[model samples]
Each structure stands twice: as structure tokens, then as C-alpha cells.
Target: MKKFIALVSVFAAVLLVGCAPEVGSDKWCENMKNKEKGDWTANEVRDFAKHCVFK
Candidate 1:
């Protein structure tokens, strides 16, 4: 049981780390702003680069 729990914890940690967004990029800043405005969504952020002004 302990080994199973440890494995699950490690898996969860890896998943959390993998899901973290890249910081300092324009997409990151836009995501932060959207979160502050309560309009953040993963899909919306994913599409941001399509309409990004930075090219």
C-alpha cells in the first residue's frame, strides 16, 4: 500500500509539473491577465498565439 501511494504521488507531481504554463512568454502574460479578469480558459489561451500581435 505504501509503495502504491508513493507511485501515485509521484505520478500526480509529474502531471502537475507538466501542466504548468511556460512563464515570461507573451502567452503566459496573457493567461495571467485573463485569470485576473476571470476570463481565463485553457482553450482560449491556446488560441491566443493565432491572434497574437507579436507575430
Candidate 2:
């Protein structure tokens, strides 16, 4: 039960983080720039390039 709750919590957190502002929007670009490069996952980096950097 404890493990299940922890897993659910992690899933919720991931879901929330993935709910970023729309790609290419000002807020999305701002977030992409401000996030620490070391902290970015592969998907996040890709998104940054596809949306923020390329824009």
C-alpha cells in the first residue's frame, strides 16, 4: 500500500510537470530557458529544441 501510494504520487508529479505551457508560447520558452540544463530529461531537451530554440 505504501509503495502504491508513492508510485501514484510520483506519477502525479510527472503528469503535472508535463503540463507545461504550450510549446512556442512565451511562458514555455521562458521555462525552457530557465530550467537547468543538467536537470533536463531527453524529452525536455527535445521539446526545447523543437519549440523554444527553433522558434
Candidate 3:
């Protein structure tokens, strides 16, 4: 039972991480272009991608 739970946990984590949006792709590019244009910082772009694009 313990081994089974551990395996399930690992698999779940992998699935979650794998579904995360990757940086510097078409989605990211579109997100950047659509964002308000006015001296946005790198961190802002990253956060936008993580929350808006990824989610």
C-alpha cells in the first residue's frame, strides 16, 4: 500500500509539471504581443505567462 501511494504521488507530480506552459513558444509570443505595450519588465512578462497563459 505504501509503495502504491508513493508511485501515485510521483506520477501526479510529473503530470502537473509536464502540463505547465513552457517559456519562449508561440503561446508566450502571443501573450507578449497582446500585453499592454509600455516598458514592461521581464519579471512581469514571466508572471503573466505563468498565471494567464499557463492557467
Candidate 4:
């Protein structure tokens, strides 16, 4: 049971980390551009503009 729980935890961590590009990276900027504008949080907008646009 403990081994199964550890395996599930590791899988969950990988899924979360693998799904999104690192924030403020070029890949993240491109991802933000493609995602719906309404879905973005205020901080994402700020970071995207700061890192992706102005840079």
C-alpha cells in the first residue's frame, strides 16, 4: 500500500510539472498567447508582457 501511494504521488507530480512551461520562459510566453485571454490571471498578464513582449 505504501509503495502504491508513493507511485501515485510521483505520477501526479510529473503530470503537473510536465503540463506547463516554466513561468517567464519563452515557451510560457507562447503558451500564454495561444490560451484564451480571459483565462489568464493578472500576474500572468503582467509577466507575459514583461518577459515576452518587452524583452
Among the numbered candidates, top lDDT falls to 4
lDDT of 1 by residue, 1-55 (tens): 9999999999999999888676546766676666654575676555554455435
User: How far does residue 44 in candidate 1 sit from its true spot (Å)?
Assistant: 23
Model 1, position 40, has a per-residue lDDT of 54
Tell me the TM-score of each prediction against the true structure. 0.47, 0.55, 0.44, 0.67
Local accuracy of candidate 2 as per-residue lDDT tens digits, 1-55: 9999999999999999799688678898798788888998888888888887776
Q: Write one digit per residue (lDDT tens) for candidate 4, span 1-55.
A: 9999999999999999999888889889889999999999999999998999888
Worst 10 residues of 4 by lDDT: 21-30
Ranking by TM-score: 4, 2, 1, 3
lDDT of each: 0.67, 0.86, 0.74, 0.92
Error at 35, model 3, angstroms: 15
Kindly list the per-residue Cα lDDT of model 3 for residues 1-53, writing each as its tens digit.
99999999999999998985565666656666776868669886776667666
TM-score of 2: 0.55
Give me the overall lDDT of model 4: 0.92
Better of 2 and 4 by lDDT: 4
How much is 9 displaced in model 4, in angstroms? 6.7
Per-residue lDDT, model 2, residue 10, is: 100
Clashes of 4: 0
